[model samples]
Target: METLRNEIQQLKAARTVNVKKDVQALRATHAGMEAKVLKGEKDLNTLRNEVAQSAEKAEKALETGALVLSVLSTPGGQKRKMNEIS
Candidate 1:
């Protein structure tokens, strides 16, 4: 009976060691993945900013084109009418 108890205790100790190692490994992996995701978010934000800037430039270019067109379409400095049917 004493021998059986000792065997059980040893088995439990081995299992505890294995569980601890597994938990450590999982934590390390989770931390690495977290770092990678943060980096990706930073890159995504940079890309989004670049796209926003490009859109702003495009809007400005279109506004300039409209201004030039209005100047050309006017007569004697009259305000140009919009082509909309409303």
Candidate 2:
């Protein structure tokens, strides 16, 4: 009976060590995944900012183009009126 008890104790100790190792491995994997998620979020924010800036620039350019077109067409309209009268 004493020998059986000793064997049982050793098995329990070995099992405990294995459980601790598995826990450590899981913690490491969780930390690595968290870092990757944070990096991805940072990258996404940068891309969003760049897209917003690009959109603003395009809007400004379109507004400027429209104004220039309206200015140029005004003179053309006046000429057309004169030509029509002639």
Candidate 3:
């Protein structure tokens, strides 16, 4: 009877160690998933920034083209006479 009790106690201790190892493995898996999510979020933010910058650059180009067209269509363009000497 004493040997049976000792065997039972040893089995319980082994089960406790196994449970702790399983818990640690689960924690590691969770940490890895969290890291992946954070990396994806960072990449998403970078893409957003690139899109915004491209839009701003396009807007500025359009404004510049409009200004040049307005300047060329005005009377000042034809009024310029550099060939006439005083």
Candidate 4:
């Protein structure tokens, strides 16, 4: 009976150590995943800003094109355009 008790204690201690190691590994993995999530969010924000800037630039280009077309439809503006081209 004494020998059986000692064996049981040793097994319990080994299991405790293994559980602690598993917890540490899980914690490290969670931390790494959190860092990756943060970086992904930052990248998404950067992409959103780029998309907004591109949309603004496209809108400005469309406005400028419309203004040019309106101006070209006028007789005086057409004469000026011809003069500039020459």
Best by lDDT: 4
For every model in order, what is the number of clashing pairs? 0, 0, 0, 0
**Better candidate by TM-score, 1 or 3:** 1
Error of 2 at 52 (Å): 1.0
CA RMSD, predictions in order: 6.3, 5.3, 4.8, 1.4
Model 1 clash pairs are none
List the candidate 1 regions with Cα displacement exceeding 4 Å.
75-86
Among residues 3 or more apart in sequence or in different chains, the pairs in candidate 2 whose N, CA or C atoms overlap within 3 Å are: none
Of the pair 2 and 3, which is ahead by lDDT?
2
Model 3 regions more than 4 Å off? 62-86
Task: Give me the displacement of residue 70 in model 1, in angstroms.
Answer: 1.6
Ten residues in sequence with the least summed lDDT for candidate 2:
75-84
Error of 3 at 73 (Å): 9.0
User: What Cα-based lDDT does every candidate model obtain?
Assistant: 0.89, 0.93, 0.90, 0.98
TM-score for each of the candidates: 0.74, 0.78, 0.63, 0.88
lDDT of 3 by residue, 1-86 (tens): 99999999999999999999999999999999999999999999999999999999999999999987786687765344332422
| Lowest-sum lDDT 10-residue window in model 4 | 73-82
**lDDT ranking from best to worst?**
4, 2, 3, 1
Candidate 2's clash total is: 0
User: Can you write out model 1's per-residue Cα lDDT over 14-65, one digit (the tens) per residue?
Assistant: 9999999999999999999999999999999999999999999999999999
Model 2, global lDDT:
0.93
lDDT of 4 by residue, 1-86 (tens): 99999999999999999999999999999999999999999999999999999999999999999999999988799998999999
lDDT of 3: 0.90
